[model samples]
Target chain A: MLELHQISKHYQPGGQLIEALKPISLTIKAGEYLAITGTSGSGKSTLMNILGLLDLPSRGDYLLDGVAISSMNDQQLSQIRSEKIGFVFQSFHLLNHKTALENVMLPQTFGTVPLSDIRQRATHLLQQVGLAERIQHKPAELSGGQRQRVAIARALMNQPKVLLADEPTGNLDSQTTLEVMALLEALNQQGQTLILVTHEPEIARRARRCLVLRDGEVVSDHLQRCTDPTQF
Target chain B: MTAQAKFYYLHNHLRSCLNELRSHALRSMLTTLGIVIAVAGVISIVAITEGMNHSLVKNFSQLGTETMMVRQNIFKAMNNDVLQPMTEREWFALQNLQTGISAVAAFSRVELPGTGVSGVRISYAGRSQIGRLLATSANLPQMTGRYPIDGRYFADSDSDARRRVCLVSEELAATLNLQLGANKPLLQIGNFQLQVIGIMPGGNRDILGTSADVYLPLGFAMQLNPKDIALEFGFRSLDESNTEHIKRQVNQLLRQIQGTRPNETANFVIENATELKQFQTDTLGTIRTVLLLVIAISLIVGCIGIMNVMLASVSERTREIGLLRAIGASQSYIQSLVLTEAAILTTVGALAGILLGLGIATIIAAGIPQIEQVILPPAAVVLTVCCAILVGIACGALPARKAALLSPITALNLE
Candidate 1:
């Protein structure tokens, strides 16, 4: 469960104040599949960063499971991010020098998890993402779809409570997009909380609920029907 | 975390750092060159100084730590009217002192050709040679703490009786084909015929001009220039511990004999083997300090080179830093990673430098026979290594801070 009260973010570049996100309040319960859709200037990515705890809202009183995020320090926030939230970036962001398995094990490196357990779980997660045969391959050696799958498995390494994906299929082909969507759909069916940020309407429709933003403000929130078949 | 987990954490970081450096081997080597040179320079300097100190100690030990020598201060003698020539009475007074002086000998010299120029003409059998000449008391060997190499030293009776007996250096004896036997070989010096009583060890000339090729009785030499040459005294203390005490007592006695007041500076200078060694050590210490300072400046430059490379690395790895931060690495963790990389780089450089430095020192020592046993002092090695690591850490600080302070979102946004 997560809640945001009057959250707003602003930036100053070259002595000019620019409002990246206007004050808005929102909440998402556990196990909800949600998508945020917006145009180029919309605050979708900013909102996703705030939700993932990667960036702080300039004026916000964010609550995660009734705990105020504002009261926590950087170290505490980092710990919460490692344990409770996982991110899937559009570019994959996998370390090019490491194998897919090492990339998947990256999150647990900062924790007290034993090396053996971390290796074992990363291998299992890679298998779950249908990357079992390609665990040893580096990101540069994998196809775009396979790289994205590796990123997905890495995001799941810590068994985070909320999975936040930012344009997960932005670089994949249409066929690979279907497979990724089916994977997300199956995860959502298993009571996993999912939050996605995308500009594509069809991709946004796959989620059970969608929010559209215009000019740093949410304009609409509605439930959607997923008509695509799960062939993955 | 458990201790085992902590170990694994550190082990992983170390491995990661090694991997990163290996990937950029050329850059790493280039970055370490400054450190290598700085460390090598310091090591070589230390080795050379230590070798010089060792030889100096050996020379002083040969003269004996307990030995004391008194010489007229030429500057004081010229400037002050109170300077008085030491007489036989003063010599008797010094020998009578109860200040643990074991033996005392009085001697003086005049350059045979007068100031600056040296050497005296001598003849033996049918050969003639030029050599340095000195006049000394019969117990000069005991007072100066150096014994003859081949034969016995002259006796006090010989000095008191004005016997025409003398010692010749091994070099002079060898040149004249003289050998010690039942019948002592006689040599002609000026207007006297003196028997060779002993052979002194041959060596380089000393500051006191005592290592002459030929020595004559003080009693006989004083007869040559009774009013022109001032006598210099050498005293042997009972042991090293008594030298300082005897020296002060003798200084007072000399002042008393001159009738100079207690507050007035003495016209004579008192020197001991111990003081000579201390002066030598102090001089060497100053030289070492200056050399180390020059090396330190070079080391700082080397560290700056390291810092420059680290700054570039921080910028190049900005995205990686962000990813690590986003994945739950603390800012301090990122800082430590960069610092560790720098430390490892300098450590490698230091090791290589130690090898190179020892090699350089060995080559230099081999070239100089005086410092034949050069050993690297352990303190110098420890000091240089510790300095390298500390400098490495200091150089890494700025770049590590830069990397740690980067905002994760901004870093992630970079392509």
Candidate 2:
């Protein structure tokens, strides 16, 4: 579960304040599948950054399970990032020097997780993501679709409650995109909190609910019908 | 808190370091060269100096830790300079039941008659040779704490009755071609016949197989070569540690007995091999310090080179650092990654250098016959290695700090 109370972001260019996001409040309960769609300057990234606890909101507070995120220190924020929140980047941000299994096991290396259990857990996660046969392949060796699957497995390393995806299929071809979207759809249906930020309308329609942002504010927040957009 | 957990963390970080090192092996080796030279220099210097110290200490101790030789400044006495040897009255008090002194003997040397610098000549049957005569008291060997090699030393009766007896070094006996083991072989020295009572052991191995100087009773020697000279008093202490105390006491006695002014240096000089060894040690210490200074400077320069390489490595991996931070690694963890990598590099260099240094030291020791043995003290080796690692850690600190402060947002915003 997550809550944003009057959260906004702004950047200072020399002397004047440039508003990247206007004040807004929102909440998403556990297991909610939501998509945030916006143009380039629609504050989608700004909002996602606030939601993921990567960047602090300029004003007001962000709450995750009734706890204020802005009040905690950097170390605690990192702990939450590792434990409760999983991020899927558009670039599939897998370290090139590591194998598929090693990338999946990266998160636990920072914590008190025992080394003996890391391999087994990572292997199971890789298998769950349908990457059982390619667990040893590095990012350079993997196909676009397989690399995205590995990224998804890595995000789930700590069994994060909320999956934050920023344009998760932006770099993939149409075929790879369909497979990745299906995987995310199946995960959301299984009650994983999936918040996807994207620009594609058809991709956004796959979620149970969709929100469209114009300028820096959310303009639409409604349930997506199966016929809302033509399926790929 | 648990041993397993601590071991796991150590293993993880060390492996990470090794992995990173493997990725940049050439750079690591280049960076490691400095520490290598430093360790090698230190090890070789320590080994050589320690070896020299070992031999010198043995030589000085062999002179008998308890023995003290008092004479007119022997070096100055040779140059016909100042100071005169003890008189009968002065020698009487020292030899008569002195507290710290176990035994006292007076010895002196004089030119052989008509031989000049060719040295004292002696004959035995058909054999004849030139050698120096060491005129000493009957208890000379006992006072000096070195017994004769084959036969008995001159007895007190030999000195009292002024009997003609001699102790020849093994080399001298060989040169004389006389079977000393036979019934009292006689050696004719300066128109008088002397029985070879003892054969002194072969000392000064460089000249061991050749003829050496012969020892004779002081009274007999005085009668045979009557050249007026001073008496050189040699005494042994009851215990080894009492040499210095006894020497100090003897100095006061000599000053009083010779009736010298308090402002004047003693007419007699006390010669102790330990003192010479100590002086040599002090001089060696200074040389060692200078050598260490050179070693330290080299190590620092090498450390700087390593630091420079680490800084370059940190900047090169800025993007990876940001990604690591984003993934959940703390600033401290990121710092350790850089520091550990640097540490691993220098530690490897140090080990290589130690091996190199030991090899060089062993080769050097083999080349020098005077060095009895060369060994690297274990404590010194351990300390050298530890110092190298600490230097590596110090060099890594700034780069690690710079890396740790990198912001995670840079992963996306900056290449």
Model 2 Cα shift for residue B143 (angstroms): 13
Identify the leading candidate in terms of TM-score.
Answer: 2
Candidate 1's C-alpha lDDT? 0.83
The DockQ score of candidate 1 comes to 0.33
Cα distance off (Å), candidate 2, residue B354: 2.8
Q: What is candidate 1's lDDT per residue for B1-415, written digit by digit as tens?
A: 7898888787667766787788789999999999999899889878877887887766676787777788776666677555777777678888899767877888776344332344677778877777767787777776655689989888778878888888888878888888899999999877679999899986424444466778877777677767755778887778676666778899889888888787776767888877867876898899989989998899989999999999998999988888888877888878988998899899889988998988898788755534635678888788778877888899999999999999999999899
| Model 2, residue pairs in steric clash | none
The candidate 1 chain A region of ten consecutive residues with least summed lDDT is A223-232
List candidate 2 segments past 4 Å from native.
Answer: A225-232, B1-10, B64-275
Q: Write the per-residue lDDT of candidate 2 for residues B234-267, one digit (tens) a residue.
A: 6777777767788888888878888888986667
- DockQ winner among the candidates? 1
TM-scores of the models, in the given order?
Answer: 0.68, 0.68
**RMSD values, in order shown:** 10.2, 10.5
CA displacement after TM-score superposition, residue A165 of candidate 2 (Å): 1.6
